[model samples]
Target: MGKWLGMCAVVAAAVLTSGAASAQSGFPSKPVHIYVPYSAGGAVDILARTLGEVVSKQWGQGVVIENRPGAGGVVASQALAGSAPDGHTLIVVASGHATNPFLYEKLPYDTFKDFTPITLLASSPNILLVKADSPFKTLADMIAQARAKPGSLAFGHAGNGTSTHLAGELLKGLAKIDINAIPYKGGVPAINDLLGGQIPMSFNNGPESVGQLQAGAVRALAVTTASRASFLPDVPSMAETVPGYDTEVWWGLLGPAGMPADLVEKLAHDFVAALNTDQMKARLTKLGASPIGSTPQQFDQKIHADYEKWGPIIKAAGMKAE
Candidate 1:
């Protein structure tokens, strides 16, 4: 009986030791997957591909970027939530992620509870733009006309519940002007309409709109940032007129909710390190994205804050899922 008990004790100890050893391997036994909840060729897509390249170099493993665009990021969010929590699967979401809770009556997953915050990659302020030939040369000019006309002027956006849409809504609430807001399937269509003179103005990404503004196809009236963008230092900030008006469409990384704390720390550390590299910065700037390297906790705090702030705005605007 003593001999049998000793053998059993040895087996139990080996199993526990092996389990702990596996746990201590620090996750990511294979390639990592990053789900992008927007269409390819958009800001989120560009940002993810750039960052993924950097992360791939760092990890020496494949980092797949999967696009699951639909329902205002619901499909991607839900897909990420269902992925394994072993730090092998992640998602890069935009500002729309925060407002989805308010926009949709029912989401397939919980935004806050189902994901572990990684780090915010970067954020860029949206630029208010109009066709180059349009008479409204400045924000003041646009505001005056809209105020005078009272819902006659029109603007275009990517979709409802998106950053562009909220920017317009915030403008309405703050400026008390009545300009019409038009939604498009994506930025390409919106820019197409803006260039065709179908829409008077548009709220597009600084990086994306810079080319058009430079080519004189579209004029940038104001950037939604509180301060001037480095790329467009001459463009005045929207806050110059609308006090306390600041809105930036941001992108961030997230993993499954139960990701091991060590793996989370390592991922955040590597990502920020990659962002600090000269090559990464240059690539991001070329893509028109500003690099913002933040801690996981800071990203989480921003998510929570933005979630609280956008809830009322979405409710007041009566924004619905598109």
Candidate 2:
């Protein structure tokens, strides 16, 4: 009887191990959720919906999006950190995900340990926009005025600690000016205020500002990237004016930490596949975004690199969450 029981125990262990392996291999046994830490129609939200369509078709399951926009992505990030580490739940986070740690006194979750990067979806240079008929004619002119007036000139950003906000701060640091920085709950409000002449200028991503630029409502002084955006080639890059200025907003996929290695691999591969499709590439290009399908390791390294790069900037600027 003892010999028979021992054999049964060994068989059960192997079966359980096989079951666990099979479960992970199968992946997305149910519907998947990709959280967006911004309001609808924003860059991250748009990319999530686009990729969700492709991935859902591949998985034959719904890819629901939940938009929890506030506190510079803290609200949604905390929710993602609390979710099960299973492959079903993920967040489409912006580059602000890396900067939050430096902007906030404390975060609800560990930025590195509480998340797993899948792959970066897209990136766009923040456009430096002023009203079409504004007096400042060139990048040099704008800097000169800001230098002359100091705190009299102000710019609007999406929110505190966001890429747009940081871009504005970077300009201050690099140009050695005293332009007041304003934070809005969303980019739309800031752009609206700019149109209303409440703020002299604003930093908005390509997607949000493209229509305004097309309508001749705003003029582009320079794009925050080191290179001119493909969609706006006539516009010069900030580095062309500020010498070392370079800032671009990026979005990526991240799941709750502790997801199985195989599951993470599959997610990254599947997302990269979706991003590489010709249809997706064209669609994103129309929105002034560039598709970037990086490996899981590459995406992880990107977060760490940005975190290191932006930490000192945020600290020196004395920025904090509102």
Candidate 3:
């Protein structure tokens, strides 16, 4: 009887190991939830919904995008960190994810340890926009005006410590000019105020400001990228004038930490495939975004690189949590 029991125990161990492997291999057997840590109708939300539509079509299962906007993306990030590591839940985060660690005193989730980086989907350069009839037509024009009247020129951003806010600070540091930063709960309100001439200019996502520019409501003075944006090639890059002035708003996927390695691989591959599709590329291009389908390792490196790059900037800017 002892011999028979020992054999059964060995058999059970092998069976359990096999099951574990199979479980990881057969992930996404149902719907997957991709969390967007911002309000609906924003750049992140728009990207999530677009990607979700493609993923759902490809997988033949729903890829629901849940918006959990608050706490500067901490609320959704924490919720993702707390979710089961079965690869069912993920978040589409931005540069704010990296900057939050330095901008906020304490975050509910461990930015690095609590999540598995997936592929970075796409990126868009932020544009400095002013009312269409405003006198400033170029980055040099804006800088000259601001230099002549320090702190008299005001700029607006979606929120405090957001990428737009950081862009403003980076502009200040690079140009050695002073322009007051006005914060709003969201971009639309700030855009409205910009149109009303409440503020002379603001740093905003390329897509968000595209329509306004086309409608002749706002003029894009410059793009904060190394190269000119494909959507607005006529506008010169800020780097052309400021030398090293490059800032962009990027978005990517992240699953709760400890997700099965197989699932992470599968998720990354599927997302990259979705982004590479001609339809996806055309759709994103219309929104003034470029499709970037990088590997998981690449995305991980980007997260670390951005975190290191922005940590000191946040501290130096003396940004406070809202």
Candidate 4:
């Protein structure tokens, strides 16, 4: 009886090992779906499509990008949470993903518990921009003016919980200046308003602001990163004026919770491989984004860090959404 039991145990172990290998090897048995929590043509959607193209080629499978923009990402996140943990369904979330829990009164899914982070695909700094003809040539100049007339200066941002809005708030807190924040439906509208002279300045992501900057239609006062962006080296970093100010718009890949460890690892490896390719590198640089392609563990840590860092700020600002 003892020998029979030992043989059964050995067979069971072999079957388990084979099952794990099969799961990893047979991913994307059908078309893979990646959900973008924003509208098409936006940075997140662009990045997803760009990366998906490379990943699909690598996997010999079709990648479908679905845009489900609403509630600052809740709509898509809810869909992801309800998906099977087989790695077929995934999402590309932005920096707002970390702060959404704090922005909304109640979320449809738990931020940390409902998903498995696959990798941080890329990051880009937000730029403080004004029309080319505006008088604020530098970040210091803008701060000086805001100090001179408290609340007289206002800056447009994509939305209340977006990275651009947070960048403006960080500037206000660190620069010790009073500036009103004007929320727009999206970044393009904010940039349009700035260009139309309706708003004096706006906070926009690197991807969206690069065109205007290159056209000389807008002047970038500072990039909201600890250091200057490689693509916009001429622009000063906000840290140069407001020491310690650092924030960025980052996007990461995630699947629904309960993904098997081996499957998660396989997905991360494939995605990171795609990100490291020369084609992806050039594409990301043109988009004004820096590719990260961090491991699952690293992505999880970043998400937690951002969640902790932004929760208090959101609370203090009294930012809440229905």
Best by TM-score: 4
Q: Give per-model TM-scores.
A: 0.90, 0.89, 0.90, 0.92
Ranking by lDDT: 4, 2, 3, 1
Question: Which ranges in model 2 have alpha carbons more than 4 Å from their true place?
Answer: 1-23
Candidate 2 displacement at residue 10 in angstroms? 46
In the range 1-322, model 1's lDDT, one tens digit per residue, is 1122224334333322332333426345688888998888877888788788888887778889999988878888898898888878899998888889898898888889999998777777788988888898788888998898998998899788888888888888888899888999866688899998888899887667868877888888988877777777888888888887878888889987998876777777677777767887787777666777666777898799889988999898888877
User: Which tens-of-lDDT digit does each residue in 176-283 have in candidate 4?
Assistant: 999999999889999999999999999999899999999999999999888888888888889888988988989999999999988987787778778778988898
Give the root-mean-square deviation of each candidate in angstroms.
Answer: 11.8, 11.1, 11.1, 9.6
Poorest lDDT segment (10 consecutive residues) of candidate 4: 1-10
Best by lDDT: 4
Which residue ranges in model 3 land beyond 4 Å of their true spot? 1-23
1-322 in candidate 2: lDDT tens per residue?
A: 1122224334333322332333365578888988888888777787888899998987788899999987888999999999999989999898889989988888999999999988766788998899998998888999998888878899999887778899998999899999998999878899999999999899998889988999999999999988778789899999999998888888889999999887877777677777767778887887888877666676798799899989998988788887
**Each model's backbone clash number:** 0, 0, 0, 0
Model 1, runs deviating above 4 Å:
1-26
lDDT of 1: 0.80
TM-score of structure candidate 3: 0.90
Candidates' lDDT values, in order? 0.80, 0.84, 0.82, 0.86
lDDT of 3 by residue, 288-314 (tens): 888776666767987898888777888
